[model samples]
Each structure stands twice: as structure tokens, then as C-alpha cells.
Target: MLGLSADNHHPLMLQRVTLGLVSLVAAFLTVTTFFRVELLHHLLWSNGPENNSSCPYGHFRLVGMKDCLSWLSCEMMQSEVTVMKLIGQGAVKQVFLAHWKGNKVALSRLAVSEFSNDFFHGLEMLKGLQSVYVVKLLGYCEDHTILTEYHRFGSLTNINSILEQEDHRSFNTWEVRFRLAIEYAMFLHFLHNSPLGPRVMCDSNDLGKTLSQYLLTADLHVVANDLDALPLVNRSAGLLVKCGARQLQGDFVSPEQLWPFGDDLPFSDDLMPPYDEKTDIWKIPDVTDFLLGQVEGSDVLRLHLFQLHRDCKRNLPQQRPSALRVVQTYKAVYTLLTQESELSGTYSGTSRDL
Candidate 1:
């Protein structure tokens, strides 16, 4: 009537309202898709890009995403890491599935706000780790964290995904896990021996140290920022851990090969503690916590690793055990025992015949 067809007026208003609603939904989803730094109870889930189903990284906090994102600026994106699919978020980043040549790999992108002290410290330790158990190094960009290696399945953080996996290649079999733990133990021992072993060791006690970029996690990996809601992510980890079905004893250890001579020294972080290899001790037991499901007892096997972890955690760093000594104890344990089937009680006390 007002110089416009009745049909035109209805559709126009509806179209405007619909467009506004769509925009709001899109915006909500986009924000929810990234890492949140808030606590689990507080961070409410709204909407976002759909979560990755088969993405190989373990339990990831949702980070932002872009479809077929371009890498025109990053030299590696074009040449080395070919971004094929998006993974999920990390403690400080988002991840992606990329190919280095023909090799399949998972990449992590860190959140800007999550760049706190602990995150960097872990990153520093990760950088110096030239060991195999950790994620492999790769190139990155301003908006992503690139990592490479065989994308086998997932991580300890997301073990259930690998467990429910029906392919003959479930990565969470008790045996494979045994090996993964043992091998990483070797990695820890190597860290103990190397200059990169202790964080302080890498830099002399002399405060004039110029931090090495190679020693920095940020240098090794790039990330997609937005880490304002951390509590949400931490609860996510706890949930993931809770979901795991097959529980390994919290102190189940691998073979003795992981222990080394350098592991026996003491490396303390107590401001003015001496330079030594003791830090390795604390790592082993906590690592044991990761490997074995927690329970308690004196199965000589566990007590050993338990003591190692305890020794390292000691307030008086000098009292700690060495990675070197730890391995030696394993050797001694093996020497006294015969095989996996041999024993009710372990040690020189009384040989409970198998």
C-alpha cells in the first residue's frame, strides 16, 4: 500500500531479522571454537565450528579455525607443512593436520594469553628435549603452531580415542604403552645428562644469561591466541583422564635401560641449589603417575620409581636420587630376580620361590 507490494514488505523484514540471527550465531560459534581460560564451572559452551572428530592430537581445548586457510606468507606452509585439515586446541594453541612432503603430522597453535610462565617453561623443556617421546618439531606462522611426526593416533591425554579405535592398530594396548613409557624415560635420562637437562643448567647461575631462541617453545612452535578461559580447558583434561578405561598401575615401570649414569646427579631449582642431576628423579615418579593408575603397595617395582619421584621432590635437593642410580637400582632388581613370573616378595630378605 505504501508504494510497496505487501509481499515485498514481509519478506524484507523477515530477511533482515534472519540475517541478523545468522550473524549472531556465526559470531557465537566462532568465539566458542577457540581456547578459553575460564574455569570449567564458569565457561559455558555455546556454539562454534564443529569439533574435529578424527583429529589426532589428544584432548584439545577448542581454538579458532579457518577452512582451507592460505599460507602465502609462510615459507614452510607453502613448501614444508601443507595444511590439510584442522585439529583442536592446545594449552596455549590450536592444532592442525598437515603434511611435510608426504608424511602425516599434527600441528599445535598456541593462544596468546596462555603464554604464561608455566607454559613457556614447559615449552622450554620441550625445546631442549631432542628426545623421541615428545611431539616432533616443525615450522609455523603467526596464526598457528606447526608440529610434525607420524600421526599415529593421539596422546595419553586422549587415550580413550585410541583405545576404542577398532583398527588392528590401537595405540593404547598395554604393551605399546609399556614401550612408550620406557622410551620416554630414556628421553628424561638424556635430558639429565645434557646441558639442556636442567633448565638452569642450560644457563649458568650467572644471571647475565642471554636466553637461546632454540631453547624457547615459542620459537619452536607458533599458536592461535585467545587463552582467556583456562579453567574450562583444565577441567577438559580431567574429564578426558577420567574417561580412560584401561587403567595401568600408577607405578608400573618399563625395563631398566632408561636409567643412565648421568641420571644419578642432583639438579635443584631452589634458587641457589647446586648444579646436578637430581631433577630426573622427581620426573620419573610423576611420569609413573602418568603411566600407572594410582594405587598403593610395596611391589619393589613401584617403590623404586616412587622413591625416585620422592627423592627428586625432596626439599633438600642433595638427598635426591640420580637417574644414573635409578637405572642401577633397576639393574640390581633384575639381578636379584629371575623373570616377570618370579616372586611373591622382592629382595635379599627372603626369596619367595616362584
Candidate 2:
């Protein structure tokens, strides 16, 4: 959640101020939340900067580029390689549009080839865990390439632009967006509580390790991508041919359904939130609170992401919930928001992120 008086110049120490308010206001409210200031950080959890924990490649270390990436490879995802138009290239990963089995799809690429397996692992986990609010994954490549739907509406910015351009009346669009964000949190919750993944690769290792890892793991990809080539895309997100998708995802609060309950993973200590689904639930109202003229500050969303993030950054993995639980809670919040007379009158804006 963010509040900036439309000037983009927010007040100082706004994160704490805004978070305190969120605590008071949305204490029991359910809304779609945008917690992560960036999705790249959210995905690279332990692999992010600010922390120099041992990498999963045995004992290697990881670094952050200040910003996310937009290009990716095929092996990163769990699918075969094919050319696709570049879509987004945020420092975290690259987004691409491609064709598979005659179906048009979107894919995101990561900077490090090693993390591809983990990238698709998360997607696979999400796939088995169903949710209407969360995006669906058709397939992935181990080369850091992820395949999903190429949502055409663009981001919330694009939607907001359309709303103003169309001269539409004010509506509860913010509320709905907030609700959708929370729904994703609930989705994560179900995942956290769902049966343990037959096998979850928690590292960013190389090919030989990947092969060995596969033998040790189950529910693996049917085949591997032809790693002889790199992934290509058309409209990368930020710059330099980056080609990963950016759905305006912000990793602010942890999902309510997710709890910290796993190996006391050292790398996940900094900025890395445990699996608590509550983290997701905590942040949406913060974003929505600010969005609906609730808060004030520059990059209010970003600041709130950090503030709300404080509560979710616990180091325990077992305490986390799956994405499914976040989705369910968010749905409930969205339903309640629709009941509000003010937003109900103009609840026509779309609340989806593609």
C-alpha cells in the first residue's frame, strides 16, 4: 500500500507512520495487497543482496544488482525452449511471450542460470496449489525461463490511466485491487499448509547437480530444455534486453496463511520472510490503505513494503503458509468490500495483475 498525494514526494519516516496506521485500520480487513516493492527480491529471497549467506551451489555466495533483470533462459523454467517476444525486464527477471502447443504464453527469465530450477519449483508449487487470483503457470524451463499467460491489460498504472482517460466515475477499484492482493496471500496459505512438496529443490545449483538433484526429487519436469541457446524476447521490462514479467508485484507484508516453519535457513534471515501467510494478509491493507488516499509519502508503496515487511521477515520457514491460503482470505475481503455502498456503486475497474 502507498500514499503520495500524487506528487511522488512522500513525507520522511513514512514507512513506520503508515504501517502503524495500517495496523490500526486494516486490523481485521481483507484486501488485495501489494507488499513487495519488487518481485525480484521476493523471488530471490535468500539469494538477494543485503545478505551474503552461502548460496545453494554448495558454498558459493550471491549478490544483488540493486535492480531486477528482464531476460531469462529456458532451463530456468520447466519447459522446452522456444523463441518468444520480450515483454518485461525488471532487474529481477525477464518476461517473454511465446507459443507452446499452439497456446500463447508469457515467460520470465532470471539473471543467474542456476536459480532456474528454483524459479520453476516455486511455479510448480503454485500450480499444484490452485487459486483464481494468482496467475497460472502452464510450464517452465530450467534455464530461468517461466511460462505463463500474457495478460494484455498491462499493470495497475495502465489500468489507472485507462480509468482517467475514460472519464469513469470514482469507484471502489482500490478496494478490489486490495482484495485481490490479499487473495494471492491466502493462496500462499493453502500451499504452506498443503502436503509437503514431494521434493522441493531449495538451491541454485548447476547442470550436473540438477541431474543428480532430479534423481533425488520427484514430480520433476518431463524433459529438459535445449540449454545450447539463451532465451530471447521482444519487450523487456527495464533495459538491456531483460525479458521477465513484472505484474506490479510488491513484496511488502508476508502472507497471513504463510508461517515461519522450516529449516532455520540462514540466508533467509534478511528481508527474507518466513512462509507465514500472515505476511501477505498484513501488507494488502497497507497498500490499499495508502492507495485509497490512506497514507502519504514518496514511494509510499515501497516504504510501506519495507515497514510491513518488518513483521514478516522472521527466519523460520515452518511458520509460513502457502499462496493458496492468501487467495482464500483475500477473496473474503473482496466480497466484504463489494458490500460497501461507496465502492459498490463504481466497482467496475479490473483488479487483476497480468
Candidate 3:
């Protein structure tokens, strides 16, 4: 009778154990679901201040202007901003990693007195062209000092090195890389159709130079960084612009950017024909190629972009597609590729089940 009781209790105990395990799993799943829902809600609704302007947090839209941060007086900047270390130096300014009110910021000071014109021009552009496509201008002081949001990853030039790190390896996928390419195209589109007028990326004379002109945000998106060389041209008024007085070479630059005059004739800025913003279009492929590094699906993306890029490289600037067109094409290709990948994954899973 005792042995029989023991066997009967064994089954009940086992059943209780199974029930306990199931209850624990259910509780864990419920908590996980709740947190995920909360996170989604926060991401959707808490992006910025409760205002109708739809601007990011700490930014407000001014009448007839893009979103902007509050202007920092020279006295306020000098008192509040603490310079940390020199991060970058260019012809016009020296950039420093700085701290402001417990936030990391980039502080730029005029480096060369001769380039004051360029520095002021960039500061004005930063103020006027404040948008989602460009880096956020936190504050500025007219004394040749400006402050902006600091991107820890630095410039797009450091993209490869960042991806190579173990902590960032998960971002090495083609989807992430393609998104970066899309952002770059969108930035170009924004510049070409800016509120100030059709602007050209005068600093982008080569691949390295082009990459250096943009910054890689901590979230892995690209934004226009160096606006010191942006110039406006009105096509309707028959106005054309040259990147610089100096002659440019290399296949990376558009054919029109090269010296059309023979070597016997000295390179003269007066003789060099000015080109439109399509010169920027010519460099799209090289920049996009660099953004879409050698990850899975990158080769396929390159193949898909080959024809469009070929059009971008056409000798005639007018023949190339507009920046908006390139942006649309990139987005479409990304959607198609992502859908195919998902379908492929589903099909493989179904095959395994069968």
C-alpha cells in the first residue's frame, strides 16, 4: 500500500514541476511583451518636444526657416562650454570635442584668419540649412566659434574601421550599409533642392574628400558635415558654379571638372567651364560604393546600381539623373532586396519544415 502511494505521488510531483516551469515561462514572456510595447511607445511618441513643428527634441522651427537650436551668446559659450580635446583641424576651423551642460558637443574655432570668410559662410549655412539631412547646430558664437552635436564615430571615413570592431560587427550587414547609402543620397538631394537655392558640394572633388565632408552619426546615419564649400547656382538664370579655382583631376571627378584646355595651355580658372550640381551626381556611385562595403548582398546591390551609376558617369552632365531620382532609385532597390531576402528566408524555413 505504501509503495503504491509513493508511485501515485511521483506522477503528481512531476506534473507540478511541469506546471511550475510553464508558469515561469509565461510570466517571463508577459514581462518581455510589456517592455517591448513600452519601448515601442517611447520610440514613437517621445522623440521630441510636445509641439506641432515635428522638430527633434530641443529644436524649434522659426518662421520661414528650418528648425534651429537656441543661439548661444559668446559670453554663454565661453562660460558653459569646456573644451576637451582637439578632434579635427581643417583649413577654416579647428574642431574640438567639448562638454556643454553635461552633453558632448563639437566646438569649432576659426583656425586661419585668411579663411574667416569661409568659416563665416559655413556658420551661416549651418544656421540657415538646419534640417534632418544636415548635422544639428546646437549653438554658435559669431567670434569664429561654433558648437554642434558631436558624433562619436567621427566621419564616414571611419565607417569600415567601426564595422570591423566586434561590438559593431552586427552593423556590418548590407541592410545597414544600404541605409547609409540612401541617407547620403537624400542629403545630396536636400542640398540640390535647398531652401537657399540649388547648392553644390564643392568639397567633393574626390572619394576621400567626399567621405570627409560627411559625418557618421552614432546611429549609423550619414549627415552633411562640412558646409564651408557649399555654393549656390540658379539654373534658370543660366548661372553655373565651379568647385574651386584650382584644376581637378582623376576619374573620381566629373569630366566637366577636369581641365578642358590642353596641357600646352596653362590651367586657368577663367578658361575652365563651370558645371551645374550634376557634378555631384557624377560622384554618387563612388560614394555609394564606399558606403556599401563588402558585406553580404553588397555585391548584388552594386550590380543593381551599375546601370544607374553608369548614367551618373555620363560625360554630359545634363544626361545624368537628378539627386532626387537617385534617392528614389536607392530606396526602391533597398525595398526590393529586403523583400526578396525575407521571402527567401521564409522559403528556406518552410523547406526545412517539410
lDDT of each: 0.38, 0.36, 0.80
Give the per-residue lDDT of model 2 (tens digit) for 74-177: 44333444556786554246667766545455666785566555455555554443223224444555545555544444433233343344443242345433
Runs in model 1 lying further than 4 Å from the true structure: 1-76, 113-134, 140-145, 159-178, 195-197, 200-280, 294-300, 303-313, 330-354
Model 1 over residues 244-287: C-alpha lDDT tens digits?
12211222211111222243543222222122334334445554
Query: Between candidates 2 and 3, which one is better according to TM-score?
Result: 3
Q: Write the per-residue lDDT of candidate 3 for residues 45-154, one digit (tens) a residue.
A: 23221222356544644323454555667898899999999999988899999998777889999999999999999988887787767777767887889888788898
Residue 6 CA displacement from its true place in model 1, Å: 99
Off by over 4 Å in 3: 1-53, 56-69, 346-354
**Number of clashes in every candidate structure?**
40, 116, 0
Error of 3 at 252 (Å): 0.9
Best by lDDT: 3
TM-scores of the models, in the order given: 0.42, 0.39, 0.80
Candidate 2 segments whose C-alpha is farther than 4 A from its true place: 1-84, 90-92, 100-103, 142-144, 155-159, 165-175, 178-182, 195-277, 290-354
